[model samples]
Target chain A: MKAFTTHFKNSSMTTTADFTNTSSITLKLEQVSKQFGNLTVLENLNLVIEPGTFVAIVGKSGCGKSTLLRLISGLDQPDQGTVFYDGKIHRKLNGHARVMFQEARLLPWLNVVDNVQLGLGKTGKGKALEALNHVGLESRAKDWPSVLSGGQRQRVALARALVHEPRLLLLDEPMGALDALTRIEMQQLVERIWLETGFTAILVTHDISEAVMLADRVILLDGGKIDLDVKVDLPRPRQRDNPNLIKLQEDILRRVLTIPA
Target chain B: MSINWSKLTGRITGWVLPIFLMMIWEIASENGWLFSKILPSPREIVQAAIDLSISGELAKNIVASSERAGWGLLIGGSIGFFLGLVNGLSRTADRFLDTTVQMIRNVPHLALIPLVIIWFGIGEEGKVFLVTLGVFFPIYANTYHGIKTADPQLLEMGRVYGLNHWQLFSQIIFPGALPSILVGLRYSLGLMWLTLIVAETIATTSGIGQMAMNAREFMQTDVVVLAILIYALLGKLADMGVHFLEVRLLQWHSGFRQ
Candidate 1:
């Protein structure tokens, strides 16, 4: 944990600003509103996430949190306004973005390595194994997805999403289907990757405690708008018992559950 | 090792009845309970098989029938598979072609025998044409069903991962539809033999059907029975071939896992 903190600090301190095609990525939404027929899912929502930031969006079931991730991932376009990736208008699926679903969405016919390689495109034979190694799944590279436990498949999916080193990684309740222990393990895995690569990460989740533990910024959405956007001022390697973390969780939970007050 | 006694007994029970029936027929023939010219005894059929096989008559008829069925299946199955893919993948293709194919499917292909005879008479073409028509529907229907029913979620995953059109088709859509397509292939093989037999019996001068008819005219009941046994063997062989293919190609399927 200390090593991770030290590494992130060092990378940020370097500040090698390159305007011509660099690694740092920024995602911005400008007055984006999406509606399905008569139903308004998101309305005039605007937010910006800086390079190498980990932000978590939490909301109730109908709060359009998933819809927000879809818009950012470029799977769907906002009906009202534009989303920008590094100042370019996000229209189709952005090449730099990748989204991970709650369900692993691993292709059943392809084995573990092939599924990872699917993300890598043509020049991916070696990088696929390397990606599997990143998620500690190099040993299960040859196994079919059907044989793996749910948690293992999710790990494989994380490998697939990361293999390409996507500039923007959008996660939609990736740990929702997992058991408590597996969810913690997956959270650690995700945090480790984010710390190491420092890609702009946005996680959409309903789990409030998860939002507190992993995210640098936790944005709570009420209906179609941002209700609370709080920055975590706690120390690195946050524990459940940490009073600061607990207090923050309580504060967010209160705002999330409040009914139009 | 202890034997699975119930399974072993069940297998034996299946073989016992057919063996017993053969024994009864042999006994009935020896006792003159069977008319010798009408239904030949098992011994006479086996003797006739040995004679025809050694004289190469059985081999020639068998080859001729198989060639016609094989060619017909090849041509019809290919066309059907291609059409199925087109109709399955493209809404435009389905709109233009699917209704016609579905309508034609309702007509029993065997009913076209008279018209087919006029179109391609007593030659090998008529028999092959009948087999092709008979085999076409099942293959087409199954391929269409297979491609149509390919899981949409998987296709979405393919798109999300940035697969190109050809890669998506080859890697996801084709394999997803393979099991259903194979089911169609298996069913079509059965239809192939059935149609060929009917066609050969109705029109042609060269196959096992002709051999059986010639034997009937001479009161060669033994040879006629021999042809029937050979037909049964050929059908079983075709089934075995298809079963082998299904196992080899679909080992990933849960049904074939164990």
Candidate 2:
């Protein structure tokens, strides 16, 4: 373990990270820590995400995976660290980033189109339509949100989050509530959109296979710290039957299950 | 088959019960089973209504009362709504005025009819004042409550979007509070009618309530009953009118749209 840490430290000192763009220093968390009352959540966490990387945070219940996303999304404040977007400190959301929650949270009063355009400014409607077309909901623009099926509603929510063309997309277990079939479909839709848009995406999920399937890097959080950072070398449109993904999922499971409470 | 029959019977009974009650009242009065002086038969009331209708007295009284109530509601409800918004949005204003307003609300406006008469004189101004006071509280209360209860998450969303204060209120807060404000309007309508009756009773010589008072003075119980029935019917119509307006304006609202 000492030799491994020393080797990792040596690699970090020699590493000269090349960002995809000069402007894409991307998202960085430096020695971040969070505490709620007396309970410590995230402690001395550090991560550097490249632009357009699809990263998944996986952890057991109460392991502060969602807290990490919230911190990255600027929904919550950090106690003792910084969240940098493109090397500048990111503060509260000012429409450059969007978060999609487990529930669709589409305003029921609005129809499909209007809800997509919601919170977006004056020129939002056209962009919203484009987004809806991306999600295959152009025909349901005038239809009320309540009439939509669960998957369709989630798709609309996806459109709403994307309509603004945000650089950062945060998904907080968005497919957690769906059934197995719908979940798989949604997972694929998410992956396709991420590929098409090339937005920096961060997802927090409990499903290890899902993390292994969708993420470029799966960060296993245990006891409010990164337990394992596994790089998924598999290519896009990965199959569920792929042995590499299966082994990676098993490895992540082992790391999480072995963590001391 | 049984369920359909039951639904059909329910519809029939809804209309049947009222008609049956009227019939019983008519029969009891005509046969002298009930005192006719205190309670006139339905036929007498209908005849009185026809007579008033033919003379155009019912129409004139309705127009006058409606005008007073309508204008009073328009002016008073608007003031109350703006004040409520101020009270909700500004803590300084709320702290300054809430106690005073609460004290005033406690004092029944009807009981101040004599005082209002002395202050404004026995004229249109006095009657309108009474009606305005009566219609103001519900609108004010509901508006304040609506604005106060607007979802904080939506407000946070506005903050995230870089919306200015005015834009936030207009786009997010106002639309969010619309349902509550409409509810206030309904309550104000009811209060408008109540105040109009008191206003006409004490001061006005020319409205529906005044007409009812005149009929009572002349011991024309049928005319009095007809006047009251007209007032009740008109109040119901006003409620329906507001409901129609609500549907038109808030068609995007899920409750009304569905």
- Scored by lDDT, the top model is 1
Q: Give the per-residue lDDT digits (tens) of candidate 1, residues B209-243.
A: 88988888899999888888888999999888888
Q: What is the C-alpha local distance difference test score of candidate 1? A: 0.85
lDDT of candidate 1 over A148-224, digit per residue (tens): 99999999999998887888889999999999999999999998888778788899999999998988778888789
| lDDT score for residue A125 of model 2 | 86
Residues B87-115, model 2: lDDT tens digits: 99999999999998799889999999889
Q: Per model, how much of the real contact set is kept?
A: 0.36, 0.25
Say which docking band candidate 2 falls in.
acceptable
DockQ of 2: 0.34
Task: Please report the candidate that would top TM-score against the real structure.
Answer: 1
**Lowest lDDT block of 10, candidate 2 chain A:** A12-21
